[model samples]
Target: MSDGTAERTNEARGRRWRGRVGLSIQSKLLIMLLAVSLASSVIVGTIGFLNGRQSLHDSAIDQLITIRSMRAAEITTALDAVKRDASLHSRNLSAQALSTSINEGFAELQQEEPEPEDRAALETYYSDVFIPELEGRTGDSYGDEAFIPDSVAGQHLQAHFTTQNQDFDADYDTLLDDNDPGDGSSYAAASEQYGDYFSRLVREAGYEDALLMNLDGDIVFSAYKGVELGSNLMSGPYRETALASAYAEAIATNSVSTVVLTDFERWIPSLNVPTMWVISPVGNDSRITGAMAFQVSIDTINALTTGDEGWKEQGLGDTGEVYLVGRDDLMRSSSRILIEDPEVYEKRAVNGGIAPSIVKRAVEVDGTVLLQPVDTQAVEDAQAGESGTTTGRDYLGGDSVTAYAPLEVEGLDWVIIARIDSAEAFAPVSEFTRTVLLSLLGILLGVSLLSLLLAQVFTRPVHRLVGAVHRVAAGDLDVQVPQGSRDEFGDLGHAFNDMASSLRIKQELIDEQQVENEKLLHTLMPESVAAKYKKGDEAISEAHENVSVVFAELIGFDDYARGLSPEQEISHLNTLMRGFDEAAEKAGVEKVRTLRGGYLASSGLVVPRVDNVRRSVDFARNLLGVVERFNAQNGTSIGLRAGVDSGTVTSGLVARTTLAYDLWGDAVNLAYRVRSVTGDPGVYVSQTVYDRTREIFTYSEAGTVEAHGGTETVWKVA
Candidate 1:
């Protein structure tokens, strides 16, 4: 062709290519329709999801608030009734006469010391029964002298009531009528006179115990006649108890109308179970002789706070509950979890940051009052006299919606809290979100299919050209367009064919080099990370707050491989490594790297998981199983040892030219140190890992090892 003719032809081809570059009218309409449709679906779905979530949250908060208010009112009413009963009994003529007579009787008994046998029996009872039971319940060690009564009268009463009777544990009232050991003594005479009346009053009024203490702080009279009877609250072993505090307050007030209330505490006389007291002056205002106290019933308090164990009936859902917390940050009521599922309660309480000793005490007492700690935000806010609702972590370390308020009981620093798990509260919103997503997805699929069909029908001649362009855009440079018509469409198709043919040759060469680079990159880093490097991300690094690291090594592989050839050694090592990789994948662990004789793996590195520690431990155990299988099949005597640690770790590409991805942190270093410790070949874990998984797996103390310039405790899984 002539130069002019060739130039004209090239210019025509360029014009055609430019014209095709702009989207067709049908394609433009389709794109606009899809964009609008998707935008509408997303906007509507988001609005609905947000509104539903807010509505559910408000409902949950309202329910919790209602429960909190109701329980607080009930507790206030119950406490007021208890105060009224104490006041009524204190003002009674018979009670005042009994108090005066009991004080005189106890003073008379103090003149004669108890027999040596009686003293020995009292000491034995306290050491073998009372102190041991108290120590077991409180997880505290105590000597016999810690609880032995110093006063002669107190010793005689305790020995006669508790040592002579073995059924007191079942019923303290049983000792009320048994006064044989002290037939002619003044203490026995005083008890014989008013013991039946007080016991009857306790049974009828639903009181745990009734007490009469003189202004001198001497507990001269007890309805049930336990160790507290005849004991001095002023200078005796029970001087520091809530009962003592109530007695002191009543004596200080020295008024007939005053009713002193003290919060619950572990009472040694009651075998360390939770006990409270309400005290009143026991004589006329002119000359008060003593104080009368009623030991408050824990069952009544628990019934009010726990809704009489009818939590679900009171609109509290499956995991919802109302509880009380004292100023000491310990519970004043029973824990619902401890009532429904003791094992789960123990696990949740320990894992939720409560001390194991506290949980053990709660279990031993068969109650949570004055034992289970509830030092949560709700408790703190309520103790500060704030009444409101909040969404945060509950005492069990689970997300929950809570309502808190201060309880209005006289002389008691207590608060009420109502809470329910967030999962149960927001379940409806979660369901609605899923429904909206599925609906939007269906709409998107339907709209895309319909728009594509309409576009194909309207632009039938451009269909083959459009398909070829889509294929080329999708990395298929070998695509070619057919030219069956002699028009602009045919000319465009022919031009497109030539361009694709030329691009295909260059793309093939580029792909060959790209594949080799990707292979080398992927071998060094994780696939997801290599993709970032391929996209030109030079500084690749991440800080994981809760990743679990595992260090696994072959125990006898070096000795076994000494007699083998290099080829066989490499093959065997490759087999072992491949097996480890498979086990790690199955256990949700990521292989970080392999050293001369060890393999390092991590969980919660690439993907965060709440149970990463558990997965790492599982992976370590599986590595040992892999080796055992290999030994069984190949007749090899090699063993596997593994150590795990869970904590913060930083992972990144280490080198510029020779990209090496590596992990470094306390967790990694500790894991290596634990694995290298001198011990038998087994799976061992750091203290953190052991704490997180101790309930799930059986373990024994593997002792401590030096790591990171400190001693780290370790445990071995059995």
Candidate 2:
């Protein structure tokens, strides 16, 4: 191949490579749109997920709170019922019948030393006659001694015995034998009758067991076991708890006391089951004689809380469980076994089967206890005697939302804790979130694909238009873009073609005008100055007082021009002043003019309508910024000195054939003198300007100076 042809081919390949390297406007736009869409999708999806999770968690907490409140209400109702029944039984027992039975039965027992056969007969006779008579009416068996019976006489006795032992023996003998029946028997029977009535009422009122204990702590009678009728309750833990609770109730002016029985047995698989006791005093003449206690089975509580009905079915899901705990933190009753750890249960059984710490903590921090999912601190704030709910990690490492409510039973400090596994509680939300995320991802993917396709479709016309414009710019005016459907891009294509045609026609005239303007501007001012004036920044008319202005003129410019032609002189001055103009501009100062072979420059508040004085000061400081830059860029010997003065100046437009606005006042004149008198070719400013800006700049006083205006204090700025 010929060398000329080979070079041409290489140049063509280079141009093609450059064209490929540059991206089309359409491609850039498509990329930006995709980036924005993806960012928006991610933000929206994250927000949706967070909002959904919060909503579900809040709902679970609310449900748990409601359940706990209901449990407290039920327990309170049961206790109140027991109290009412015990009070009624105490009030209904007649004092007269008690005295009469004791008196007459004692008299009859004293009249005979009864045989075993007689004793059996008397017991039968008393059961059939006196007991029936006493049970029939409120006052019929209440005569002084008429109601007591004897088996030998086969009749009722009518007498009174005064001795304590004789009276007790007569009462007991009359009720148990035909003769010599002790008053104790009659009193015992009466007590038994009253106790049986009391127990029956409590049982009918829904309690599983009931007991009546005297002030001395002796169990007089119990519904569950009549065998322990005469046993002293003071030795037992159950009775001790009851006594303490009763005393507390009395001091606190409360009528009921509730406590939990935490001892576990082989019968109970879980150590959490607790028995609740409600104790109320049996009173006569405003003095408490004894206390009547109602005992409810833990199983009954479980049944009530986890009934076959919709109690758990309502809002609580399948895995949700409700239970009661004593103030001592022992589980009274629960629908499910809460103690999941076998080791813990074993330890509890070995340690008296009571969770003392749990009870204390519950009372101290009356909120949900979660052991799994994650360890959380106890909710101690809930024990303020108000029902409250909280959520935390449960044992087994799962999220749980639980509610706690204080139960006001007579002798027991108990609370109901209703808990639901967070997973089960918000299963619906989890499913929904999962479904939504999947759906959104799919939708986003589909949208992205569709956007890509749409981008391709729309970019085709834009790409073609770009190619046509490039061809025209490369001098291929014959190139034409195919017209697609009438759209914005179609109009753009037509506009581009018209613009190219117009540019081709006016290229010569425009180039000639540009060349002439450049030459004329260069002759009138330095290149930097001409550029600034072209950009409409002719004079530093926006200059404020306390700003520095600098002016420099060649000392013998006229003499230098004497031997040169007009063009040579103009060119030399332009070359010399151009460096200064560039230096001032780089220093962030406005070069106002370079007229009649002189230069004028000022810095600080030079921009018209500037609102910030500090910015103006910053600009003045930065004016020195350009001087150093200029010296570094060009190894020049020339230097500039500036004078700054802090004072007011008049700023307005001046009309010549061409309009000009400039700063004119004593401050500007003084600034000029300060710059001219400077011994060194650096910056100089009046004392007023120095004072205002000294904190931010290093400077030295140039003492006082006499200028075109008047003598003023001046300082040099570095």
Candidate 3:
């Protein structure tokens, strides 16, 4: 045949071969197996991740709901207490008689107009002190004419108690103690006679202030002698405020059992700090005369919502808080961020679309009540009387998991919300997602490798090699393929065995390195502390309130060490230190660290104990035993001088590069000082330690030593 014909024939033959071998059975099977494995892994991992995420989200919402319910109940209980107190005070005979007397006296005094000097003093207070302070807080300029009282009695009372009191401007609350303003007016006379009664009531009941308003809404008496003492609630500068609204509601009810609670608002008479009042009509069942008001303390409300500033202890984590919002979408309780870090709050508030002026006023007043706007979806839903949990933007415009419910407080449009930042709330879910994705990737990689290996080793002669490959893939690195065949398969088996050996060696090295790293980490700190460090918390610190500390100095050890060689000295020191550590561990004391010739240990640093001082003294006695044993064994005249103190101490990791756990505070310092006292070699304890452990262990009074503030009495443990 010719060359052209031969080329055409070869091309046709090559095309036929390509058509027949396009996808081999092995290749097809491998592809199908890999597809199945990949689909299975995706399905399983996706389902698991979704389930875990939903569970975490649900848990976060449920936690917030629980906190909201708790805060709501507490607020309701507080309001109920206020209502009870108001009812009790309204029914008291003294309150009724004083209300009648102050009203009659004020009406009679109004018949005789006040002098020009007294009126001028009252006008000066409104223009200079009250108006300036109110403007400073509310950021609104006011005219003195609006606040100036029209009644002579009002002017006279203001002149006597408000403008004349020296400490009124500095601390208006102090006026509660100034019963007699020396004005000799009937208001002052009434205060002198019934001042003790009202003072006792406010002090014992924890009311910020008390006011008696007549049937005409004229405030006749004030327990704290504030600017509100003479102001008229029905037709005064404060008539448009919540205080007047609540008073009107109470007076209109005409029932002593009815108590109206007003939501927090800026009351100028109180210098515009957030104030709420509980109003109840003061009357008998037959006739209603007037209404009485009890000023609810802002601190009391803040303490309830903020959990006394112990948010973490109350289970509201770092970014979680419970707060109240009014119908106007303004916060009725203090903001957590405002309480924790006001600068951060200002920055975040401005960034979150809140006006800088609002944040400025909030910071200036040192409060968030009726200042920080919380016009969030949660607040809106809660104000609409709905109770549920949802994830949405918080007041700071950060995504949050929030649970909200309308408060059951009568005469108030308020809702309670518990919330935490979404970043913190869903952190575990995010971690789980990352872990699932990585695990799915690992699964796909393993399945692909397994399918390729299975497809490659299907022949009878390569069965032994296939089994060996499978074993190695299954993490059994000890497997060896048979080399009986003298063909290429045998060479392949030899290579496979070598690869397995190399993998085993590498894995062994990796495990050894991991073990060494763990050892080094644990050697630097306690196991718990090491775990925290490994988890990326670099700043590990804890304040131990009542841990007993001990500082022991090796008496005469330096002289003894000078006689020995370097190696001998190190060996002896190691032996003595080891003995001391064993004794400390046996006595339930944690060895803090070892100095050149000193040892420090503490009890209740790692764990809290009421008898820490006693345990610490016992540990000190064990050190004496340890030193005695060391001397007896080595025939040396070495002694141990130790001191112990029981009080608060701070302990944490120090040095970022080379971390070291250390304890230092008043207790630690006094313990070290007491150890080096100019006396015989023995254990000495500070007065704190002695006082705590005296009932358990007998102590002899030793000489006093100079301490931080003055002298601390030392006691020798006998």
**How do all models score by TM-score?**
0.66, 0.40, 0.59
Q: Which residue pairs come into collision in candidate 3?
A: none
Show model 3 residue runs off by greater than 4 Å.
1-16, 25-29, 32-36, 39-53, 165-169, 441-718
Give me candidate 3's TM-score against the actual structure. Answer: 0.59
Ranking by TM-score: 1, 3, 2
CA RMSD of each candidate after superposition: 14.5, 29.7, 19.9
Regions of model 1 farther than 4 Å from truth: 1-23, 30-53, 165-168, 171-173, 176-181, 284-287, 435-446, 462-479, 482-718
Residue-level lDDT of model 3, residues 653-706, one tens digit each, is 888577778999989999988876755778999988887778888888877888
**Number of the top-ranking candidate, with TM-score as the measure:** 1
In lDDT terms, which candidate is top? 3
Span of ten consecutive residues with least summed lDDT in model 3: 482-491
Off by over 4 Å in 2: 1-20, 24-36, 39-57, 94-199, 235-274, 286-289, 307-309, 335-379, 384-388, 395-397, 405-411, 448-718
In model 1, where is the ten-residue run with the lowest total lDDT?
A: 174-183
